[model samples]
Target: MQLLRSLLADRDWSQDAVLLSRLQQALLLLRDPAASLDEATWLLVADETAHYLDFRRLRTLEAQLRGCTQDEVRYTRADWQAARTAEAALASHLRHVRFSSYAPEPVPMFRIH
Candidate 1:
């Protein structure tokens, strides 16, 4: 994954956090009665993309199951659970690592010359 490699090399924590939160929200929406199956599937794909961006392997086997068939792409309950677990763990780890690295120092205020 070029995306993951780029994200890791660039280390843009704010962008990563925003994307992660959006992925989390998408996951929640996937569980809602009003959400379409297609929407849920797209959310899962988005979740996978976010995970890839974070350089994390998708915890769910569903990530592997994706694109297996043309008609059906929905993840099983177990798959969703695995995805959630992976997302939570990766998000937590990223938050801890990214935020902690900057906590000790104040950002420099620049005066344009």
Candidate 2:
């Protein structure tokens, strides 16, 4: 909500693009049980970094919110829908953005002789 709005306002397109890319990778790792513990840990760290960035953005939003009256801060159903649509598009775009290290297909498990 407010946090998301703040992030959108404060962060440049490049930073958002980078963070979204990381988020996509993390989501992919989370979906795979076979991913290594180290991979999972790295993803968690990335998640925390993103959270910190979001927190900073939220703080800025809070300041803006404080300046406005209750009426000005009110949300409508259309606002909520717009936010959801934006979030979904960001997620989808991030997931599709290829990284040099990321494999297009999951690695298959093999039995060692």
Candidate 3:
């Protein structure tokens, strides 16, 4: 998450590379041919796809602004905000998933006794 924040702030090429590097194994798993994940796992991945594409587009925008100006690009503040919002949403979901894993399911009152 920090990496992504730094990326949005600095638009450094290395940050983007680092982000991909950190996610390399997951990416490979996600892209594996003839691979099947359980429904829960696929649901998790499905949730991420939108944010992933949002940042993909944001990354393109970041690439354009990196170390030079690309006037031909039509990027604007509203577009940038949309990307940031998506990233934030993804981060929130990740945090929720991370912590929720540690939470125990509540026992039914009938079963508690």
Candidate 4:
């Protein structure tokens, strides 16, 4: 992460020209603005670019995360309900945990003379 950040920090991606071009294209494709794109370029976005991605995890959610949307990320009513429930559960758990069998032994206070 540090290395990648360092590399990208300068914003000089000339070292990896191909990756820079593809990333730029992907960003533009995502925007899909009013500007018209060439047919070949438009078709190219459909074909997966090398070193680019298709994240499967975003589509799949574990049983615990049942409230999340499947297709795209959007906060739903279920998500709010789940969040409130989790927050309440966490508070309850913390309260229970606070009442230990006995208080921990106290350490000597630092003396600064």
Candidate that would win on TM-score? 3
Query: Candidate 3 or 4, higher lDDT?
Result: 3
Model 3 TM-score, all chains together: 0.31
Query: Against the hidden reference, what TM-scores do the models get?
Result: 0.29, 0.29, 0.31, 0.25
Question: What lDDT score is found at residue 87 in candidate 3?
Answer: 80
* TM-score of candidate 1 to 2 decimals: 0.29
lDDT of 2 at 21: 63
Model 1 lDDT tens row, 1-113:
34433433332222446665655455555567796546655765566667453333332344455745412444333554566787889999999998688456876898998
lDDT of 3 at 110: 81
Q: Which segments of candidate 4 are over 4 A away from where they belong?
A: 1-72, 101-113
Q: Which lDDT tens digits does candidate 3 get at residues 29-112?
A: 556677656675556445445454455577576767674443335554456667798888999999999878766899877855
Between prediction 1 and prediction 4, the one with superior lDDT is 1
lDDT of each: 0.52, 0.53, 0.55, 0.45
Which ten residues in a row are the worst by lDDT in model 3? 6-15
Question: In angstroms, how far off is 22's CA in candidate 3?
Answer: 38
TM-score of 2: 0.29
Please identify which of the two predictions, 2 or 4, would achieve the higher lDDT against the true structure. 2
Off by over 4 Å in 2: 1-14, 37-113
